[model samples]
Every structure is written in C-alpha cells, then in structure tokens.
Target: MSNMLLTVEQAAEELKVHPKTVLRYIREGRLQATRIGKAYRIDRAKLDAFAGVASGRTRPPHGVRATVIVEIPALTTEAAERMATFLGAAALGGDAETRPLHFNTAFDPTSGDLKIVLVAAPSDAARLLELIELQLGLSR
Candidate 1:
C-alpha cells in the first residue's frame, strides 16, 4: 500500500487521542515523523504500526533521524538572517546517501525571537549544530 502522510490532528483522530498525545509519541520516539516547519507529518505505515496494524512493511531502526530545535530570544534580524544563510549553505553540501536535510528558521522581528528546526541524519545534525555554535560563538 502506498504510504500517506498524516498531520498530528489526523493521527490523533485515528487513535482517538488528543493531538498533543501524538506530539508526545513523536517526542518519545514511539512514532516516526518528518518535521515541517512547526508541524509534523507522520507516515501512514508508521501510524498503522503504532496502532498495531500490520502494514506489511518493517519499521526502520530507531534513531534513524535526528531532530534539533534551537531557539534564540532577542536575536537581531541580521543575526537570524546570517545564521539561516550559513546553515542553509552547510546543509546543501552533504552526501547523496544522507537523509534529506530540513532546516527551518522562524523569526519574529517584533519580539526578536528566532527558532530553528533541523532534521537530518545524525552526522549531519551534529555538523549543523557545530556550524550554529560557531556562528553564535558557542563553540567549546
């Protein structure tokens, strides 16, 4: 069966639980998902497996994906743009076998809040974090 992507609300409805519960499942590593901006998309096969349905597809090993969220309050717009640009460039130069990298940056100039979400292979995640640390003078 072709896998369909479901939103958190949809998955929660299917499981008869609140949307937050699905988010918890994702956070606890009980379910697999692809982070899109501030939202998550769950594969139908994974949802079926989580619900104890036979999907005829084996689940991939845990920790196959690495998700990193970084928040910077009071960050200047210039700084946010610089960080995003640097991270985007770094994210684009990975091996083809590496999982596609997702780098999302949300900035609110009014509040000077910057939130960055990155999802990719573990190595790629680490590298991106290093870039971020270096960019923000957090290297140690």
Candidate 2:
C-alpha cells in the first residue's frame, strides 16, 4: 500500500473545497485521516472514496480482473458447503501482493439453487471456474 499522505490543504485543493471543509469532513467521519501532532494527514485513496471517484490503488496497472457469477440449478447442502470451503480456501491462498478476491455465495435449499459471485484476477477466476467444473463433474 502507498503511504502517500496529503495535508488538509492538499486534500482541500484536490477536493476543490476549502481546507476548513476538509477538516469538517474529518470531524464528520466522512473522510478518514490521521492526526499527527495537531496536523491531519489524509490518504489519497480515502479522499478518492469520499469524492466518489475510483482510486488507482484498487486496480493494478496492466492487470485484468474478472467478475463471474455462477449459478447451479441443483446442489445438495453438503456439496454446496464443500464447494464453498474449497473456494474460500483458494481465495485465502492467493498471493499477498495481489488484489484480494471477493467471494460470495447464496443458496436456496428448497429449490436446490446455488449462486456464487467471484471477483478476482483473470487467472484466479479461471482457476476457480475449473475447480467448480471439476466439482460438478461438468466438462468445459
């Protein structure tokens, strides 16, 4: 993570607001900052979040990300639990420097429907897809 710190004045300039406004945001918890000996230091990423802009910190340069939603028409509870465990383990085993993977699952017991949402790098997504296919005995 970049330790880039911006002073209140710098943050205000980037935000196109007054310095006091930035301070007010800090007070209101709208913006996150660190107080160092009476001076507030704001993170560029935090500022970007407050401004409703995408931070460069999220996506690495030249990197490809994938968002995949997989739906299983029918799955047993035990099978779904096993799949979830396997996917979660894979997500947790990703490289430390790489962007973290987001995995979510929803299941309907009555309908035997299982839905999985995965946000990860392209390679990781492919790996997870392969695992899912293998678990489901589906070729492709």
Q: State TM-scores per candidate.
A: 0.53, 0.55
lDDT of 2 by residue, 23-139 (tens): 987775556789999999987766665564554545557767799999998889998887877776666554335566677899899988999999877888988899889888896
**lDDT of all predictions, in order shown?**
0.78, 0.78
Model 1 agreement with the true structure over 1-140: per-residue lDDT tens digits: 53789999999999999999999877755567899999999988667655655455444567487889989888888988887777666764543234467768899999999999988778888888888888888888
Q: How much lDDT does candidate 2 score?
A: 0.78
lDDT of 1: 0.78
CA deviation > 4 Å runs, candidate 2: 1-59
Which 10 residues in a row give candidate 1 its minimum summed lDDT? 91-100
Candidate 2 similarity to native, TM-score: 0.55
List ranges where model 1 is wrong by over 4 Å. 1-63
TM-score of 1: 0.53
